[model samples]
Target chain A: MTYVKPLPELTHEDRPFWEAAREHRFILPRCRDCGHIWFPPYSSCQKCLSFDREWIEASGRGTVWGYTIMCQPYVPGYADEMPYNVVLVELEEGPLLYSNLVGVPDEEIRPDIPVEAFFDDVTDDFTLIRFRPRNRTGE
Target chain B: MSKAEFSGRTAIVGIATSDFKALYGTDPERTREDLATHAIRDALDDAGLKKEQVDGLITGGTVHYEPLAYRAGLTDVRFCVDYPSAGRMCPMALMHAAQAVENGLANYVVLFNSLCFRSNQVKFGMGGGWMGTGLLYDSVYGMASPGAQYSLAFTRYQHLYGGTEEQLGAIPVAFRKHAQLNPVAIMQNSMTIEDYLAARYIAQPLRLFDYCLVNDGAVAYVVTSAERARDLKQKPVMIGGTAGRANFREWYVDLDFWADACASMKRDLMDPLGVGTDDIDSVQVYDNFSVSVLWGLEGFGFAPKGQGLEWIQDGRIELGGELPINTSGGMLSEAYLQGWNQHAESVRQLRGQAGPRQIPDCQRILYWGLSALPSASLLYVD
Candidate 1:
């Protein structure tokens, strides 16, 4: 079954980040001048205001900085996925990303827990970056 | 300019709110403009100023100021502006209007905020996908609602600061107690800490009580120069000092940065007001979410870092405690007119007109609000 959730509308600046997710590869925009890596890809470095930037591949491993279990469905598309965990992961490369934590129960999730990225192909055109416990054995 | 130059330059002479009870249910018969008109007329009457005396207008959350002025029977508006920003910018709007009156661009200015969320069936979290820029990252993950966004931040605060659900539960419990004393509050029943804990979690770590009520209503305040306000009907609630700051870079996505944003407000606002936290008789911190109030308490220098929940647990923030907070129920129990209602409550406290909820000898009060981008603070004195 295909996931019927609201998908990201790719933009000119953010296309590369979403395109990499489709191929199960995580990429972030890094400032070529200041060496500042940031999320939600932008044209310039937010720190140094430099337009010189490059797409750097991430290790796909991070610690859970914070998370919340959205028990209520604020959006209609998420009605079926009610009571889902939205996790903020601070990547080893030093950029935070928002994604879902899979392969773990709600009770098991905690801050600073190690997690690795895995792509869930929700539809042919869209793939979502999800996370799972790093210390757990093969699924 | 020196601090004394800005202190008591302008005053909020009159304030009013629409029928909060009529706002709870669907009011298809009334439009947002009607509420604005009602509040404006009532405020002018309270000030004992004729409608024609209003020479300036500042409106929030909507862009019906021209029609609102017409409906309120104001024919002479020298200066008019509209701020479509969040409720947190209410203080900023007041500050701008005060500046206008002080500069002689207008003799009298009115700031009005109104919303029909219940009647319009507006959902705050839905609609705006990512809301542009840095917020898109969180939106893609289904972290859209302000409640969920603030929950993530509050959860991180608890992790770093050693807070507990039971400790945070004290906030809504205190707010409900204040609400019971306010006849106009939407939630009149007192709530206990146990009731707060038992409530279901909309966003983990933030229970139902942590969120604010979404009833429809409007609030308006009339502003004029301090010299002119002295001649008005009610004693003027002088605007001592006002300041605003924004986290222009990461914006709302970073929870840890909010403390710094608020700290900037302290330096810019509190210093100019010439009053320390100890001097304030009461406080009206924005309670869009309960944790924001906790953040305000610490960020505004009432409590040290990692000690906000402790301050609440000690019962220092409740009515009759060391410092009373949100004596009119605030956004938590009162109708959410953004932060407009807070301004009205602050003025009431300063004028000693709060009736049963009045703080003893309330002469000075602080108001703080934090929207996603802009955070503002105002010091009001009698």
Candidate 2:
């Protein structure tokens, strides 16, 4: 089946982040004044309430902060993917990003598992930031 | 922090839950107005107060204000406002109503929540409206409603705090057992921990058994000053104290599992009323998901953090045990009134009206829900 999943509803402020993802680079809004970073793309710094922000590339290296498996297909387009896992990967930059942990089995999934981001160009307009387990030796 | 001066000044003089069908979609014809008016009239009757005496009204969860007041025959309600709907607004409505009455803004206030998820499943249930507005951006990953959020949090909690799915089964089992004594509860069929394990998982680490029922229902509470409660027909359940804080660190997730907010409210609300966890005869927690029960207990100082799973075992949270929780079966087995009925349950426990589920010497009760900004941590006294 074609992709029937709910896509991100992006506003102008949230566009740059996804636009960067389309280029296989993950970016986030950094407050120029306070050096605070955030995810899912907000306009201003949640801390210090500053609008002085610079969009920069993120390392996209993160650890598995937490994960959950969907035993029931609650959303549209997920019926065939029952029991799949959605993970919260806390990037080294300290912002938690929501993505799927690919190339790993359910039992192997646990917190603090090292993972690295890989971009998936889902459609002509959107590229999602997903993750896969990273091995030692920096491979 | 010092004790709030508003402590013990206002009391819940009346409480009633609307008659609900046994299950969702069974009563699709019942309108929201009828449900709200029924509970409001019943609550007013319980306090022996005329509808004209109610000058303040607060509503939650799909309940609009002006039409409801007109249908309920409440005239000249001076203070009318619609609080946000969902589990969190349950106690906030009660606290707001009490503040209005205590501050002399109104002589008597009625707070009601009418959830009609049955008739409007697409709007309330299937559409993901019940989950707060943020965090939908990750829907591509199959991250559905708040259940999945709890699953992720509970998954991390299991890693850090060491709780097992087997031990977590006790929460739903205990609440279902309590439902056997609550005549008004919808899911009164008895369940066991083994049965809990057998149930299908809605989200991993959280089963179908762990979720609250999504049935149609409404609940109302009559609020008045303690001085005015002296002449009421029923024993008034005094509003001893209330405190609240934001539990969010991320957009919508509490990575602490509501520990900080729970502890903050416990110190501010309970201590000021001269009550502790032991002194609290019962607790009514927001059981939108069963894990929240343990989260609330641990954060509110009933059990040490990371030990609630151990503390809740072996009928400890059951009725007549150390601290009976969700005695009206809560939203788990009882109808989901969006935590509104739990407030009524606390009031009933304090008034010694919980029937066979009543706690002995129930002098004090706590109604708490872990929530974002403007949450509620309320205490009631007999």
Cα distance off (Å), candidate 2, residue A118: 0.3
Chain B TM per candidate, please? 0.95, 0.94
Candidate 1 off by > 4 Å: A135-139, B131-135, B249-253
Best by DockQ: 2
In candidate 1, residue B108 scores what lDDT? 91
- What DockQ class does candidate 2 belong to? medium
DockQ of candidate 1 (2 decimals): 0.54
**Candidate 1 chain B weakest lDDT stretch, 10 residues:** B126-135
lDDT (C-alpha, whole model) for all candidates: 0.81, 0.80
Q: Tens-digit lDDT track for model 2 on B1-382?
A: 2356777788889988965544356555777777888888899999999998889999985767888877777777899989866668866777788778866799899888887776766332122322234335567677776777778888899999897999998899999998899877888788988999999988787899988887787888898999999999988787876677874555345888888887778777877666777787788888888988888888888889899999999999999789888998888988888778888888888877878988988887787776455255565664
User: What's the TM-score of each model vs. the native?
Assistant: 0.95, 0.95
lDDT of 1 by residue, B209-316 (tens): 999988888898999999998899999888887777776543354556367877887788777656788888888878888988888888877888888898887668
lDDT of 2: 0.80
Among residues 3 or more apart in sequence or in different chains, the pairs in candidate 2 whose N, CA or C atoms overlap within 3 Å are none
The TM-score measured for candidate 1 stands at: 0.95
